[model samples]
Target: MEEKKRSGAARYCTVPSCKNNSVRNEGYSFFSFPKQTDRALIRFTRVNYYLLKWERRNMTLPKVFVDIVAKHPHKVAFYFEDDIWSFQRVDEYSNRVANFFLSEGYQRGDCVALLLESRPEYICLWLGLSKIGVKAALINTNLTGDSLVHSIEVAGSKAVVFGSDFKNALKDIQPKIVNLKKYQFNENIWLSPPLFDDAKDLRTCLKEAAMDAVTEHIAKGNLKDHILYIYTSGTTGLPKAAVITNVRYMVMAVGLNKMVAVQNNDCIYDSLPLYHTAGGIVGTGQALLCGGTVAIRKKFSATNFWKDCVKYRCTIAQYIGETCRYLLAADDKNLVKHNVRAMFGNGLKAQIWKPFAEKFGIKEIFEFYGATESNSNLVNIDSTVGAVGFVPFYARFLYPVSLVQCDEVTGEPLRDVNGRYITCGENEPGVLIGKISTLRAVNQFTGYADKVATEKKILRDVFNEGDMYFNTGDILMYDDFGYFYFKDRTGDTFRWKGENVSTSEIEAVISDIAHLSDAVVYGVEVPGAEGKAGMAAIVDQTRSLDLEQFAEGLRKHLPVYAQPIFIRLMDSVELTGTFKLIKRDLVVEGFNIDIVKDDIFFYDVKTKRFVPLTRELYELIMKGEISCPDNFD
Candidate 1:
């Protein structure tokens, strides 16, 4: 392998180990070692080195932002709907935010909940709060009622600052959050006061606040101090607040910047919600840390996705798996030629990988895999179709990530006769884990704010007695070429007909065959069934799903054991802010015709067609009278 000097990327060679001095020497010849190698590890080391530099300089996110502002004061920081915010303007706005909060006697370590959509001000609010050492709990705007209240309560937010658009949501939870100081920001001049008597006019307060730069004395904190509390999607229950320190944020932001080779002039088109890690930190950080301009969107629109990219002259774009599917399914009229050369995000399924790349005219697809709080991160720099990331067999120890055999139902690591966790071999699906090390910030696990919830994600005594690893709660398999592919979520896999059924795999097959953009697969309970039976909820708003064709596709593409026993035709599938499918509701409403208003069908093996799951058929399944297809051969 020849060493290529990429801007913002570290020099790395094909040396088997990092200790090799030959590769470090200048003008050393680089050649392939026949073993698969990953350049991402080199990028990880460079990020680690940068973190060390920040530590030495006593730097934090706010400090770094101020530095960037000083260097590029006139550069456009963000582009919103017909509005461009310069770095100097953002700096001044954040300073006013810090000054106002500081004058209000808000002290260090205090949590302030922020409920706002994706916009330039959203970043400024959190950045300003962090400047004064106040942690901002980035609340999901879509959350309401108990979930909203729980997110705020979990973070112990002393104050809640929200946009006027979300005043109603705040009003609904105001009674529950009695101690919270509410501040409503109306984008337009408020003709009337806030709906609540206690809510203050934040826009007025910010206007009166001073714009003097907040000194280092006020924003004093180590890199380890928590700067933001980003909540989880709350798919199962209430969302858990994940603690993000300055070093952790830098690792996510700068790591991606170097890996994807984002230049200072590069404009990132970010349509994802800012509350999530992908859009909030990684996407926005490109502008703040890398001096690039970010084009923020209120929400993702498949119809307007490419248009915004072309409008902003965006050189880079961001997406998730669902976003890609929607764009692919969108009308060709919405498609347009754009300058987007590189796209980065997770959940780009292999089935649509090539088509998405070709259709969008994107050259590089930086598909990656990792949870919001997990230390085990992987990026597919090679663009191998469907591979989330690659960690060579020889480089596993260096990366400190491994696939260990785990129980599909519990997602717990399985122990051998020697009481040690078993490591999965090549092509064997297992849970991914990253070793928790305190030596480096990149490898350190800065878990959720909930200690018990945090402890649950850490597995102790994995391969050694005292060693610990962060459980990613994801099943993955690696090939001989060191390419790793995502299998399914740990609990998402269920045993059926003495064989394991991967919901992700089944969902992909169903979606591809039905020409549907959205499909969710889960296991449902059946009386006298040894294990949960496969059930699929596919979005078919027009009710145009051809049963005969769908059944024939399933029979040909999927094994009988993996086939969905029940098919649901839903008008729409509910998704999280990041476009992740919400499976809890569908799983809870499992094939119950009375509770579920959507059309349901049963796979009749004899006729090889999905028939209407009426009250008669529902009762037979409940009574364990109907036989499920176990084998077609």
Candidate 2:
């Protein structure tokens, strides 16, 4: 830290005629990483070897704006559609932006909301905020109106910088804000430009930002306080903001980079929507930290995706289960032409995992599990073939994770009088409640002014009196190998014939049939079926699914009763602010064929034309006597 202070005050003298004249300070800025020989860095990077030596100690995250410039200044730091930013230029831009934020009264611990997409601007803002020790509250640009407002308010932002495209959403809450800065750029948001016209054009906006900054000196804060909030896709109630504190789990950057050992020359094609953690935290962050460049995009586009990967020479990439599946559905004469060696991200299903890897010719597939708030993450480096893998922390809790049970009839969690909820044995499905302890380091939620809403998520007196745990609302079923399997989200599980059906597990199969871009599975009400009837809303890939073909496939694959009673062909599935499918809205509408205008599909055991779901068929389907699988067979 003393060395850090002196860094800003260093000076040099110019000699004239063999006489040293005056000294001028060439002060190093926050954006500067101290230069070192290759020898020194090789020695320093050995810190990776003895990291446990520094456990429980404070170490700043190596801001890529600093370290990256020091090592690979001229290498591309970011690339998008047709634009590219060099590490040197990115370092300079982030420095000016940091200085700008500082001049604007932004300081350490101050929350600055970034409403943008996965552009270079997002990276610049992230680096700039970290350099100045300000906390970045990254907002999802997809959110609109109230959902957007609720997120910003929950973050307790000291300032906000809105993108040009989302200016309308910003305008909705400008009056509610105390201090804000409206920044407009070209149409694509979050800094990664589709193309860089010239350095001067890029510099113009940054220079304006620098001039308007409002602080005397930038504050230095602990790494734990740097990032403030990350929003979860609210499929259940409203979307809630999750904090990303440093004190708890160290950012996974170091471990993940080590797992991949990505080369500094690697160009990581990352188009996973900057609002997602994979894009922002894991994608860009991992690449930048390794001195590799990030090839970014606003969102994933199946058509131009691989072309861009080859165009940018992407060596690494990331994906969700569905995105990879989408790619699998594409025409792939050129899929093998790209430089994609390894891919990382979650949600890749077991059934398709092997096929996707083999088809893509991918060398490594890294499957990981984590949430924005949890202290645990399971990283699968061994390509463990088809498991979520294991983290020590997660492995430690698997037994406890399965044992807890909630009421079947009512969703209200049942707790003992002592407040300690019982956990399931190994491999049993149960809700995962994070154990609260003095050592429990986690990013607490950003409450929406309603304490009751906040209180609903907490469980008290677990394991001991006064101990509290946050309800993750996710159910996990563990395998015997310390690998936990993802179960359905709360309310996604339906009971039929006294058996629980995981909507996700079922949809994973339904979605694999080269069918739709999306499949949202939910339980619909049935008159006598004990719990709920399994219904699926599918968005057909061709906009027209052959009912006979789909029914034939479903009947061949699924159990007699497991086949969906009704299949609604929807043009679009409504997603929440966080891009998660909203089943509640789908549930409210139910299976009323007349009430919903979307194309309804029904399988008739006698004459299965995959009939247009009518009121009479829908009524019969809900009566528990309909054997949907018997139609095609």
Candidates in order, TM-scores: namely 0.75, 0.64
lDDT tens per residue, model 2, 1-633? 455334322311111110232211332233432221122234324424423332344444433235556776788888876877887777677777787767667767677777766778777776677666776777866555445666777777766666556665655555665355444445533465432111123335566765322233223445445464676533233345665654332345554565546666677888776755667777876555556778888767777777888888888888876567667766776464777888888777666676677677677777876666543444555454445544322225421232367654333456776666776666677766655444323223333234565576677776677866766666665543344566645654554432335566557667766346588877776543334567788886456666677777666545444567678888776664633236666876877866788887765666744677766766776674463442110
Q: Name the lDDT of candidate 2.
A: 0.59
Q: Judged by TM-score, which candidate is best?
A: 1
State residue 34's C-alpha deviation in candidate 2, in Å. Answer: 43
lDDT, candidate 1, equals 0.79
Model 1 agreement with the true structure over 80-112: per-residue lDDT tens digits: 989899999999999999999999999899999
